[model samples]
Target: MFPIFNIHNVLLLVLFIISALIFDNFRHVNLEVIKSFLLENIQYIFIFVCQFILWYKTGKTEKAISALSDDIYKLHKTFQTETEKKEKAISALSDDIYRTLETEIKKIKTDILTLGETFKTDAKKAEKDISIFKDDVSKMCETSQNETKKIEKEIKNEIKQIRETFQIKIKTIEKYISILNVNINQIRETFQTGTKKFEKDISALKNDISKIRESGQKHSSQAGSNLSLTTNRISTIQNSGYSDTETLRSDFIALVDQRSKRETRGYFTPMLHALTEEISLSFS
Candidate 1:
């Protein structure tokens, strides 16, 4: 009973206890009275205490689980962001490389076209020289033939060098492409592995949550059943106490009546018995 009072209300608690005793003339309370009071009040107190404890524990567990889930979610989101950034960077690099290759290819084409135009101009100049030196037939013909052969050799050398340069550029582009493919494959593998790991972690978290919920429910059901059983026992005991008290009052009244009559006592016995019966009935 004293435990039922809060520390801050100790004065009020003391006053209430004193009043109860004062009104009851300090009845030197019996087990039956205590049991009846507990039967009426203890069930509610027990239920409230149990529910509060369960709610507190469940709340804490859910909070912890929620925090853990948030952390995992944040980590997964960060990973995805990082992966996207890396992919964008790789894409930018590939685009830059492609642009550079295209520029190089365009420069090669321009150089080849300029070389062809120079060869054409040189051939036209040789033809004009041949017409002008028509008077020196044998000498002019030999000189023109030598010049034509020299021009053809120079053109062949230039064409060979251009072809070699183009082949080297092609090889370089192929190497870059191969390297890019390898990098892409590696990135994909890493992403897949990370996805699998996160999935496993999420599954495990879900299982733990399910187990916690099941355990909480089981404990709640057990507590409810135990509380029910206790209430029933208290009710049975209270009823039994009431019947016994009634029987005792009746027996005491009969004994008093018999004794009073035997001793030729006064009219007080009937009135006392009636008052006692009324008080007992009120208590019951």
Candidate 2:
């Protein structure tokens, strides 16, 4: 009814026709004769049409299924290739990261070792410097002590020499004083004798007495000036802290010799000698 041309429909129509032809002569003929008639007059054209239709539908369906399977296989291959590439990239990145970390760690370790060595070297240098400083200080202290001892010994020797020189000067001064006393006594005795003989030689005795007095005055003044000059020299030497006793003694002796020379050349010495000769002449 719906224009059916399938193999099953054609097959059904052929069976109906064969059944109709066989039933139509069923009372007047045998069954074998009817089947022979159907075989000879059957429509083969319908069977051919049915087989062509079936083959055409099956070929189209197989082509569609094959094409779909090929597309699915291509998609699977692409996904697998992308996955492998991603895994390789990740593996490479991991290796690079590990190598970088290892290099950095090694560099840090080397730096730490170098720093440790530097610190050790600095510590040793500081210790050596401290030892040298201590030695220098010790040497300075020893030298200072030695210098102090030398200065002390020199001062003691100077003091001893000064004392000996002072003693000698004191003895010389005492002797000079004794000689002056004896001369003064001799002068007094001559004056007393001259006074007792006043009428006989008054003018000559007066002249001699005046000359003696003048000489004494001049000698006293000269002695006083020399004593003052010597005192000033001694004071200057003491104030200056002169340490050389031999030099001091030599200067003192030079001063004394100069004074002796001055006295020998002065009027005082000749006047005193003339007075002594006059007294001897008077007695003669």
Candidate 3:
């Protein structure tokens, strides 16, 4: 058989653990009243103490959750910051592209204007030169069209690249979001568990405090009763002493008066009277 140990602690912790595991935060009404008595106090103190220790662990887990949340938040902010940077770069690139497009258009317009101005100046001579120049113009037009197509292709490719990059970023963000949701769920569970533990501990503490208060009250009442008894005994002694002193005073007064009538009652008699008066005054 197992030897009996610190029964109070054992009972306290055992009851708490059993109750927590069995009830899972369910009510145990009047546990306080039941445990407030000596037997129950001894039983539940261990459970109460254990809960107090777990309270620290619960707080630590909460802190870890908070730290993880901070990390996730920082990751998200970094992603946003990088995205903003990419967008700004794309904006600048787009502006440059638009400016190049405008320049090309201006070049084409100037070329067309030059050909028109020359064509009207000399008809026959111009026709002969125009025939020769038409070949050059056709070649230039072909080259220009090819260059424009190439630029358009390049722009389309760049846009496709940007779209692909954006898609990848979106996927990453979703991944981070998924992780965040999981962490939050875990933290929530921890909080729920921790809350129940706290309740369990609080219930046990209330029981202990109640018992201690009852003990204090009992002790105080006993002490007061004892003090009253002592006071009464003291008063009895004082009364008895007073009565005895009065008897002694009566006898002494009778003896003095008799002595005064019998012979010489001297100045010492007054001294004795004064001494009695002083003694009474000293007591007062």
Candidate 4:
């Protein structure tokens, strides 16, 4: 059998004995026994009371520490949540900034490309225009050179024709001078051979010849002046780079007509009359 007097049983028996003793004292009214029992267990009772007070104080302290730990944990969790929110806001703001910058950069690149294309087109157009201008200048210069050569050739031919005509007129004037000299020699011979009547006839013949010579000289002078004026007009026209043959012809014809009219009225008719009287006198 197991031992019946274990620690729990012994404690129970002690508690029962103490209870009976208190009961018996209370019933018999024994104050001294009661006082003696209390004195004997005083240390045990004081120790029990002190242990209970310590347990209560330890429980209260544990509760206060738990509540403080809960409050600290709550505060830490709130801080973490606020930190996460701030991080999200910063990330969102960074994304927005990056997107804005990227869009602006794309637009700038597109504009730069467009500007480059425009410059290239303008450069090509300018090159074409410059080429055309150079071609035009070359053509104009060639045309001017051709025209100048043609004008020079025409002027040379005109001068040659004028010179030929002038040479012919000079030859005709020399022939007339020879004829006048022959006539003057014939009059001198007649004057040396004749008497008073012959002297009168000779003087009249000399006067007639003098008049014819004066008229011939005047006609020659007028012809020379007209020739010089025509030459001057031709030179003026050539120097001015004009070529109007029709106008020159008209002017020449008018001058010739006027010269012919003057010669007929002033010299030719009088000369014919003088020649006829001289022939009649010579025959008589």
Using TM-score, rank the candidates from best to worst: 3, 2, 4, 1
lDDT of 4 at 171: 82
Model 2: which ten-residue window has the lowest total lDDT?
A: 240-249
Identify the leading candidate in terms of TM-score.
Answer: 3
Worst 10 residues of 3 by lDDT: 259-268
lDDT of 1 by residue, 64-145 (tens): 9988999999999999999999999999999999999999999999999999999999999999998877768978789999
Error of model 2, residue 112, in angstroms:
22
Clashing pairs in 4: none
Model 2 agreement with the true structure over 1-284: per-residue lDDT tens digits: 22468655676688669658757767698879868866875667467567667866775786688888889999999999999999999999999999999999999999999999999999999999999999999999999999999999999999999999999977876776565556546555755655355424446545645655567756887656655665565455433322332333344345345446454336345555565455444433
Which lDDT value does model 3 have at 230?
55
TM-score of each: 0.26, 0.28, 0.30, 0.26
lDDT of each: 0.67, 0.67, 0.65, 0.66
* Residue-wise C-alpha lDDT for candidate 3, range 74-169, written one tens digit per residue: 999999999999999999999999999999999999999998888777677878888989999999999999999999999999999999999997
Go through the candidates in order and give the C-alpha RMSD of each one to the true structure: 72.5, 31.2, 67.1, 30.2
Which of the predicted structures, 2 or 4, would earn the higher TM-score when compared with the native? Answer: 2
Tell me which of candidates 2 and 4 scores higher on lDDT.
Answer: 2
Q: Say which prediction, candidate 1 or candidate 2, comes out ahead on TM-score.
A: 2
List residue ranges in candidate 2 displaced over 4 A: 1-131, 199-284
